[model samples]
Target: MSHYAARNAQGHHRVHKNDPEAIAHLKREHHKFRKLVDRINAAKTPGAKRDIAVELHKLLASHIALEEELFYPAVKSRGLADEVKEGLVEHDIQRFLSAQIEAMDIADPLYGTRLGVLGEMLVHHIDEEDDEMFQEAKKLKLDLDAMNERLETREHQLKAQYARTGRIRTPALDREVRARNAV
Candidate 1:
């Protein structure tokens, strides 16, 4: 079974009641990110790895949109400006690596190396985000349930967009890109 399908069959463990709902939601995505990395490692053939890579890219793109569009901005507004900036930079690195990975065939000599590097980076990024930024956000006293609700809606919209076009982008990220390019 697919990692996600297997997880669904098992059902989610209960999250702590005191945990921020938004953070809980994001933690789940982070878990999936790690699972996809495992899938890459376990894939015995290039074709299988290629399919997993594409799925990971779609999910990562949408997940990044969630953070860039809503989560980080909300945290930054609460005075964690430096943390938010750092998170955005990490995301940019991930995006750059993902683009390169997509352009390469799994049969390429460097394909596994590059994918492994990206996987390592993702694991590091996820750890920092979860251990540092998320912990801080929980203490920032944002409206957790409301944030989770919006994140849920955004996820649905992004999934729908990907279903229609096989890609995802957000106006929030578009504006950010434009601003950076204008400089």
Candidate 2:
């Protein structure tokens, strides 16, 4: 039997699939993300598109922080770091594109096209997680309630900071920290 599975009372090998409550929350967030992207695509007014994109960006940042800070570490502890490597890169790519989108004027010709590309990449990334990373997580011995609480706590922290400062962390702050640490 694989390390993640054990013998049942009937002497049959049983595979473990610890479906954390956080997984459900992540799925719901994924659904919301898809809806927001669809709203952006279908919006008739530039103002509406810009508003929805801003909301989407805030939520996306929180979601990414939760995954990076908590969810990915938990999975990586189970010897699945390689499985999540692509996801981390994907997050960085999305963040770069998002920054460009935020700098863009809605009237710019590439604005719609950039949003379209981001939406396409997001859908592809989510599907990849659902198919591969999620399946891998199912085998790990993650605590359902504890994992959920951890995710919620991280999300709450990110959301509150975003509400107060309009961003989780400013690039200037990051650079300052790196400079201070280098001394």
Candidate 3:
């Protein structure tokens, strides 16, 4: 059975299948990204802005990794076909932007413009995920408590692994998410 399907089985009967706690955590991270963007824009020192941008890049990367692994698959399993496809594509776009931001020098004159564009992309992407993907998850009639527990479990696993390695286990999850949808 899928991990999410297992989660659905782990709790009492309910109307939702994923963890609200996980969602709340993700929301906080999204806000952090917004604040990072603000910091990158507001800083007067090039060195400070550059440092902030580097940290922002890492945060965005990890956040995207979590969603791609845990959140999107759950929503897709609940039958959000178009949203799932578009969301993956959106992830690719964001990854591209993240890479660009990572490579560019913050002291360059064009840094703000580049960061602004990336911030705009992120804002739009977050809106779609929260509005469409997350809303679709809420519409699912599974046992929410069970799902949340499973999410917490899965997130714990991911976090533990990240703590050990200081990076995501990307190949494994990439194969898992894509293969799950591909099938």
Candidate 4:
């Protein structure tokens, strides 16, 4: 029997056959991201806006890394290649916009507009992932508990690396930023 089936036999019926813990973690992060964006939008001072933007950027960078490195790969291995590819493309767009936003002064007129656009894009992306990709992953019966533990470990490692370097780093995003800077 599958891990989930065995667990269900023990009355853990709420545990999904896939990775419920990982999905819950992702959902929590999504909620946090939306709240952070809302806080950014409501900020009245330039300093407040800048601080919130930095927080949002860090959260987004880490969240993207978690999904791309672990969750998406697991999904793809389960035959969800198209969803994974689409997600990566969206992450690229988000990373590009994040870089642009990071370079902007909070006082700049375009700053708010750019932030708004990013928020909209993120909302749409989150909705699609939660509704479609996650649903597909569930049907594929992924080992979500193991994946969640891996994601947690990776997130901590990334956070420590960021603290040491003073930058939110993800391999793919770092390369993309470097390429953009080169040109």
Candidate 5:
């Protein structure tokens, strides 16, 4: 039996698909993005509005990239194929919206419409991950403590990469981390 299954006395093996630390980080990013969105909507100066919107776009895009690269793959590999697949589709949808948001003119009257659309998509995407994916991941019998440790390490690496290079070094580091931690 796997170490994970061995640790859990239950007959069935447990899997912790989503690490709490990573989920917490994602939630924080969501909150930050929402705040930026609100700030974008409330700003009076076009320059300030545009600047906030641009930064908000970059933040959302990077957060999504990090999640896709680090988080989703780990959860998907934990036997939740359907959930991960759905999440990928949602990620694509969000990416499309992100592109739209990125391209929009913040000074245009239609900007509000695009921002509204982006907000709706973001809210829905976050809700799905938090409610469905997270709950299911929490039930998995995997070593969440170890997973969180790996996530912390990877998040640090990703942060450094983004800081120095301004790009997410992707595909995913999760697979390698998971394999190394595999029972």
Candidate 6:
């Protein structure tokens, strides 16, 4: 039996270890992101590349919001503060790069270069979260099934909101915009 199987056999596996819905959802998102990255890299025409980039941006923005709003808080509450903090910083970096890519003309040579760099950064971030952070989270006694339900609901709401507004409403960004409008 595997280590996880053995742990479960011993009745020591956490709720997340047994039923990892939130983690599963995050992994599915990562897989989709990876496929989109590959498509972006293989795009032949500038228009195709631009279209894929927009799709990627929307997908990643929603994914980041899901993590920041739900997954990160759950993990952080379980004593994974460092990983959550690093993940937030990485998200900021990705947002900056994504905005830069969006501003550049698709025909520009640097556009592809920036897209490639963003793909690499995304891959690295995904690997770290999947390999290290998720493992750590599984060890904790978190109610992952509840977290999963919350994430799923929020993800659906965000997608619908995006469909209407064409942008992800991140909490931080919403707060910032609200504060600015109040001035």
lDDT comparing candidate 5 with the true structure = 0.62
What's the CA RMSD for each of the models? 4.2, 9.5, 9.5, 8.4, 11.5, 7.3
Would you list the C-alpha lDDT of every candidate in the order shown? 0.80, 0.72, 0.65, 0.78, 0.62, 0.78
State residue 118's C-alpha deviation in candidate 2, in Å: 0.5
- Clash count of each predicted structure: 0, 0, 2, 1, 8, 0
Q: Assess every candidate by TM-score.
A: 0.86, 0.80, 0.71, 0.81, 0.67, 0.82
Two-way lDDT contest, 2 vs 5, winner: 2
Candidate 4 to native Cα RMSD, angstroms = 8.4
Enumerate residue pairs that collide in model 6: none
User: Against the correct fold, how does model 5 do in TM-score?
Assistant: 0.67
lDDT tens per residue, model 2, 70-149: 78878988888887778877887787788899889999988888887897798678766766787778777877457889
Candidate 4 lDDT over 68-161, as tens digits, reads 7889889999999999888888888898899899999877988888887897788678767877888788788778877899999999998998
Clashing pairs in 3: 16-144, 19-148
Ranking by lDDT: 1, 6, 4, 2, 3, 5
Candidate 1 residue lDDT tens string, 28-132: 787788789888878888778878999889988989988888899899999889988888888888888898999997789888888878887887787778778
Give a tens-digit lDDT track for model 3, residues 1-183: 121222222222111334365565565566666667667767777677777877777677677777776676777777987898887877777776777766778677877777767877776676666556665676786454455566567666667876797654678756755664563
**TM-score of candidate 1 to 2 decimals:** 0.86
RMSD of 5: 11.5
Off-target runs (Cα >4 Å) in candidate 6 are: 1-19, 173-183
Runs off by more than 4 Å, candidate 1: 1-15, 181-183
Residue 159 lDDT in candidate 5: 72
Kindly report which residue pairs in candidate 4 clash with one another.
19-144
lDDT, residue 166, candidate 6: 89
